[model samples]
Target: MTNISPIRVTGLSGNFDMEGIIEASMTRDKEKVDKAKQDQQIVKWKQEIYRDIIKETKDIYDKYFERYSKNNIVSKNSYTSLSIKSSDESIVVAKGSAGTNKINYQFAVSQMAEPAKLTIRLNASTPIVQQFPPNASGASSLTIGDVNIPISEQDTTSSIVSKINSLCEDKDIRASYSEMTGELIISRKKTGSSSKLDLKIDGNDNLAQQVANDNGISFTTDGEGKKVATVLGKNLDADITDENGRVIHINKESNSFTIDNVDYNVNSKGNAKLTSITDTEEATKNMKAFVEDYNKLMDKVYGLIVTKKSKDYPPLTDTQKEDMTTDEIEKWEKKAKEGILRNDDELRAFVEDIQSMLFGDVKDIETLRKIGISEAKDYNKKGQISFNEDVFSKAIVEDSDKVYKILAGYSSNSDEKGVFEKLKDIIYEYAGSSDSKFTKKAGIEKSASANANIYSKQIAEQEKNINRLIEKMNDKEKRLYSKYSALEALLNQYSSQMSYFSQGN
Candidate 1:
């Protein structure tokens, strides 16, 4: 069964080379094994090439057409991007959501929302005892709004700031002392008229003395001789002109508000003429990029279909590789693999379908040509496309929705899908691993098993055939050796008898 040439073995008939004769007889058997190996190699090459095609096609689908891609042409916003700007960003700023194209001259501001602020000038480096001493202290508490903070003799200006700021969650107020400004500023965490800060000194006035001191900010005498410490935040009040030209007064708790899906921020007492418009130029650029990628993919597939093969170069045999170096073998195989897919029915059909889908209209509303793209002028370029930016820009400016419909737009009707959707479906027919044409025939590299493919099964069959042939060859060689061994025994017996007769003579 082995294809290794047999060695000559001498016997009683020393003149005869029996193993050499048997080796000569097995030439046809050796050729059969070589032929099977060559056939299997060709099939293997074909399968590998098909997988490469699938990889490239899948890459093309992912780049410009894939939904997850940031610059995917399928989604208009991905390519063009959404943008909104105010006439004056300092005075007011506007932010718009998707599908919001225009936000007309919308707002007039009277006053910006202010947080309730109280400034107690004190250097951060100064100790609380040096700045404000205890007011006949035994135990004292300072209540700001509804939260109570305890006073300590060891308190520094910074430590007292932390004590008040810690209760910010309760009263929505914070305190800070700046050494440079020498200001101990306390402010509400939130803005607007509803947010207010109040101070009340109950028990001992020690804590209040450390804060307001003698500034008359805490427990000041009221008209009825009762002490009151009250401070309030200013609300954001603005007159915004509605779409119907009606002026509406806005008295909100926050400066930022959204109207008709458009978010507006009142910066100061100024007006901002807000407007949102689609950037048609950007949209056209995105569309052109899509067309360029589409052309590139077409050129790749068309090259595979139309390129001519080198008839002289076929998959090499193992014996042939023995005489060649790695680089030489690679060079030979490059020619061998060239145009192997040329005139391939499956690949040809795919290319044709893609070209047809490219030029074809989508739902009778848009086509590649209508959107300023057309097939290449040179027939040699095959199905590659040339983009006209002017036509596309103007078209989108008038009705970009139509352009979207042509590329990739959502619709319940699957039959009315855009070019990208249709082409993706076609590629999936060939490349998709689930019972796809390519997968069913050759199977993909990542498939469950290589033997799951038709070609792999054929290769497996060839392997069995090679094994069977080898076994048969081995059996024949064994039988030949047995026959020659018997003849050697007979010859030895005859020579011995002849020697006995000669001795008697």
Candidate 2:
């Protein structure tokens, strides 16, 4: 009653090949299993191709078109980024940024603002430690404008200045002591007329008097003959005149002033012209890069659509693979994986939607052609687009707002949407959120359960069919083997009976 495989067993009577008979009979079942397995392979390969497509498409959206991206075409950098220049950089410098307005004006700097200073030339021989006695903790305390600075008994004039500065760092005041000049300078850190400083010694007006009496500082006497602390500070005073012969006087606390979208950082009293021009260089670079990546992605996606699905190359069976070299298997699979999404209706529609939007009219802007983007002329590059750097740069200079609106502007109405908005909408339709069509069909690529998509479910069904076919084939093989084994036993018995009859003769 030993259970031996019929495939392994051979016919002993009359040299008949019974194994071949069983295999020939199982041909239909084997073909069914192969077909189901190949279908599953196709589904799996298609999912992989779709994942690659999703990744590439999403990358384009995030890198160049995202709002925060440095190369975002919809932001001010593409339309309003300016090249500002000061005619006389030594007198004034103009810095124009993305949001800075275009301006052509003359800056007449009458005076460069200086911060308030309370200068006192302390005695060269007696340092601050000796002048002011240390408190109970053997540290001297000096209060200036509500900021208390701790000075060690061994602290030098420079050390005390350092300590004062360290404590008043955030207070917009600075203290500096010059060893050679013996000048103790405490100044408000800002410029212009509103900059002010207070150099008062808490509870000791006499100490200030004593320092002044030593020729360290000069004190002003009030109408009542009381001493007053005087520190001189002034605001920035300048006049700005435009090309239209209009003059406006400006007096502010800081030397850095921004007016009419131009930042005038002046340091000297001189006349300088500030002008804002187009940032053509950066815009040109961005446009070219956008076109390059855009075309690359388009070519890839469209290539998937147009590529003809290879026939006759199905998933290799283990037995077939045993005869194929690794390189051969790779080549075969390469053919098999091609055209997994070829002429797919959804993807074709997605590509066409993007193209139509990209080339179609956007608001008053006629097309991307107006901004110097157009389809490639080459027959091989039919669906792909191209960018003209010179034309784009000129367009940005001539009518940047038009270009901006065409490329990056968003609108509630579909026809009014810009290139970014239009493309984003198209991409989103297929792959945007969790509920997106491609997401629901393919699941999120690279996720733990990425393969658990619709196709995978189909593949799972195919797997069930394959397993069922295999089980049926196995059962059929067992039955066929049993039948053949019985025939072989009968033939052997007849042969033995004949042999016994011959022996008796």
* Per-residue accuracy of model 2 over 367-406 as CA lDDT, tens digit each: 6666787767774553577778778877777766677777
lDDT of 1 by residue, 158-178 (tens): 777899888655667888888
User: Model 1 residue 254 lDDT?
Assistant: 83
TM-score for candidate 2:
0.61
Best by lDDT: 2
Q: What are the models' TM-scores?
A: 0.57, 0.61
Error of 2 at 324 (Å): 1.4
Candidate 2 clashes between residue pairs 3 or more apart in a chain or in different chains: 192-234, 192-235, 192-236, 193-234, 193-235
lDDT of each: 0.70, 0.73
Give the Cα error of residue 225 in candidate 1, in Å.
48
Give the clashing pairs for model 1.
1-470, 1-474
